[model samples]
Target: MAKRWTAQDVLDLARLYQPAGVLTAAAVLDVFSPLLAKPMTAEELAGRLSADPRATAILLDALTALKFLSKQDEEYSVPEDVAGLLAEQSADNVLPMVRHLANCLRRWAELPKVIQTGKCAETGLGFRGTDADRADFIGGMNTISRPVATGVIDKIRPLKFRHVVDVGGGAGTWTIALLRAVPRARATLFDLPAVIPIAGQQFAEAGLTDRVNLVGGDYYTDALPEGADLAWLGAICHQNSRRQNRDLFTRVHTALTDDGVIVIRDVIMDSSRTSPEAGALFAVNMLVATEAGGTYTFDEYREDLREAGFDEVILVHQDEFMNSLIRARKT
Candidate 1:
């Protein structure tokens, strides 16, 4: 028999945000950056962070208890492995993603009002703020998407294609991974003007600059570059309504060569739509963050593809992480 949740489980769930809050607070306070050099007592850390000593002590103890930091003789230090990923100055730092999640937490707090009004909160969801924030968000995407790139590529197997068009490809992480897997294949990455520069930098760093053609435009209004044998849309459809996706698919169809393939990487639901718990929860996230974004069933994908004049729509992969793959061909 399967284990069941008890009252204690309910309490645990209720307090689940505590650890996340602690981590977010640490990120906001820039605590990990200071600890990268050496461990410090709460007083010294407070001095470095310009925080209240007593309050800093409390937060340090919480971090130590959570294993994000270790306590040794009153000194608090981030673990060596974690320091590289959490420190703001580290090359591999994911502080931007952490900060973005911290921002998401604030938006999620408005869920009740959003449900009551059937509208998003005043803040709105699209990328807002200066160029720095846009860059950070794109970098955060790179950090989060890197780990899953291999799994997604494995499922899609783009190795056979001579050229691929990565639509709405942020930071070119997937495109880079594809190039690494298929040495002979080249790619075109399309994204917003602001994002293309970042993708160019990433491509340059990966020695993929010569192999990729970077195009910049709003995918909603602009025509995609033509003559690609494969078009990849990673985590794109969930942000649009069925009509919008159909229109986009039609555009993509026009951009591809004869018999070109289209691959979609996203959370694909069963007809019931409830079995994949993550997809269901992500639908809620879409509700809060987008005007019409939500998870779609495989049937919905097939129907949309058919309506857009594509054939052979089929699921290539499905997993609990909501990283499902669907493929279709234009003949």
Candidate 2:
């Protein structure tokens, strides 16, 4: 059954962006890091951040109300639980994800214009600007994915491969997971030139540097590094149109050995495209973020794969979000 809406509920839903705005603003301003060091009055924080004192005070109060900070007398500090996720000093920090979401919040705010023009919204760098935003986006991928990669790879255990090409492999999170799963396997991590260095650093940290080759090139125009028996496309399909996916699949087919397989990890929508609430909302995210990108259904995947010289297409798993798995063999 559908949800029955009430007036109060409707108003509550409409006002959801308030908290998100406050949180994103705080993240963009990097309010948590300084507070993690020591409690300070709003004036001190504002002076350290070079922000408006009055505005900083209001923002700090909002963060305190949201339980992201603790207030004592006139001083404010990050709460322990929030500090673990938001403070840069913490080993398990998700500050990058918070910063990335701040970028998304900017694009999402222009949804009305996108809907009117049928084009992606124009996004601007908030607070810190381009380099930090790019770093945050890539780092956010690792922050969210590294923890779950092992469990997801475990689902397809006993997986053997001599060489695997990790397409658009950001920060080598998935490549590290795959190589760790199959000890003898080697991988070619292909992404944009800007991302290769970051992935190289991660590969070194994972102690898998010798086993992986770092290749930097745009997969859309440049040929993928060939000779791989397996290809892994993690969370990349949703950022393209069906035609683009078919072209990409064709490239993967050519890059693979005769019997090589391709495994895609992304959201797999139902026929309705609405059953998985996350996938549906993510489609809207693509709407504001890309010219022609959205979540796809299994049938769409099967058709695209088949058209690209791939056979035996099957969805190995159906996840509500990016964990869904689809497999196809080069025919």
Candidate 3:
């Protein structure tokens, strides 16, 4: 026997954003960080967060209902399991990524019009805003990508490579993971001019300053640094059109040695392009966030790699988290 879905379940699915909205609001208001100090009544928490007491109380109650916060004796506190991840002062804080998702909610609101017109919103999708917004976006990316980097590195198992070229490596998170796994290996992290300084700081913080070469350049325009045994492209393909990906692969081919390898980690769709529900939903996300980006199938990757002068393309690993690995080698 199994439970049956009902009309109420459909309504519940439609209202899923309610809990998400509550969490996003809390992140924006810096709610959890204050709770780390001590549990306080809604009025005290409102004063600390500069929010309306009544509204704060409602939001805090919603968070408690969602198990993000624990409420007792009219005071609210973050649960121990997630306090480090939500607190702004903690190194493992993911508030930046939560803030980024909050921003995405605005773009998602335009989905109806986008679906009707087959066009993205009027505002272009590339990083747009002040220095602070840019910083938040980059930091958010670092937070989200750190865990993915560790998983990708475990699957990549780059123990044989002496040098790695991390194309479009934001904040050097994946590069740091690779370097840590292959202790004797060094990496060249290439990213935008503005992002290179941030990656420099990350590498320095990881005590890997001497092992990394930070290069600032757009992958679309400038040539990648040469002489690397492995070139890693993590979460880069879904941001470009097929032609752009082919061009990038050609550039990577030119940048590597005769026997060098190219590894791509991204969401890989099934041949039907409908399985892996997350990748399917992420395709819609690309529709709203990028001009020509969308998830691709393994055949498309093989074609792109072969046209770029690579041979023996293979699927190295596939994970439900959308962090699939595809590897190709220059012959």
Candidate 4:
């Protein structure tokens, strides 16, 4: 005999689930950004945002309960991790990626059509839906991607590559990180032409303009610059299908100088397709958004890199998340 789940038990289980908690966390984290460098009471925060003070109080309390904020009496402050993200506009605006889901989720509702057609909805680059959405999309993406930049530097500190290319580098977080880490490093951020002006400004602001290069064009369609010692494919591969990923890598191999290496940071699944809830949910996101995009198992990627002519492929770990750092050396 087995114990049956009661209606209340089922509802409770759903209420206590991870997605509900993560969404709540992301929202709370976003609330901290505009208020960075200044602490405020709930009433003040509510006033600044044109929201209800009582509601803001409740929300701040909830965030405190989640350990993302610290509250005492009526004062509230973001946690160190939350504040770190809020301090940098270009770090990785996780808020945008989260908001990209509002209309984007509608595509999931049409998954039946997508499945039948074998095509996922194209949500276009970064921004979405409205003007405010455009701002949020860019902000959120940069905020969320800052960790990848930090993680790349942390993982590859031992390497002394002089010339690096950040494939699909968008706003240049990876290039900035590598240059800051290795004073001798000179790096290029390869992205669409629309992305250059912004990336140039970012590197300049970081005082890294001298060591940085902005090369704008689609990596798949353009010629990769030769003699680069390292390249990064951070968070970009999960946006394409298997064949597209293969093609991207083949193009990468062609761009590398002999003995060059490619460093990829992405949400890699455990080989058994278990654990790392973020990676699992990100798979759902890719399914809902990309016709070909979905996070893959490391074993799958290793094989792909090998097929693309990398002689040695190594997988590393991120300290804060289950995402894997993949480095493949061209023979």
In terms of TM-score, which candidate is strongest? 2
Q: How large an RMSD does model 1 have?
A: 2.6
What's the TM for model 1?
0.90
Per-residue lDDT of candidate 1, residues 1-331 (tens digit): 7679999998999897899888977876779988878889999999998889999999999988888899999998889778988997788899878867666666677889989998765564423346755776678888888988887788876458889999999999989988888899889999999898899989998998999999999889999999999999988899888999999999999999999999998888878887688898888888877888889998999999999989999899987745788999996
CA lDDT of 146 in candidate 1? 94
Residue 9 in candidate 1 has what lDDT? 95
As for candidate 1, its clashing pairs are none
Q: Which stretches of candidate 2 lie over 4 Å from their true place?
A: none
Q: All candidates' lDDT scores?
A: 0.87, 0.92, 0.87, 0.73
Q: Which candidate is the best by lDDT?
A: 2
State TM-scores per candidate.
0.90, 0.98, 0.90, 0.71
Candidate 1 runs further than 4 Å off: 1-4, 50-54, 72-74, 123-132
Runs in model 3 lying further than 4 Å from the true structure: 1-5, 72-74, 122-132
Tens digit per residue, CA lDDT, model 4, 210-275: 887788788767887666889888788888877888888999999888899998888888776644
Q: Which candidate model has the greater lDDT, 2 or 3?
A: 2
* Candidate 3 per-residue C-alpha lDDT over 129-234 given as tens digits, one digit per residue, 9 for 90 to 100: 4564567777998987887777677886646899999999988888999999999999999999998888999998999999999999999999999999899998
Q: What is candidate 3's CA lDDT for residue 224?
A: 97
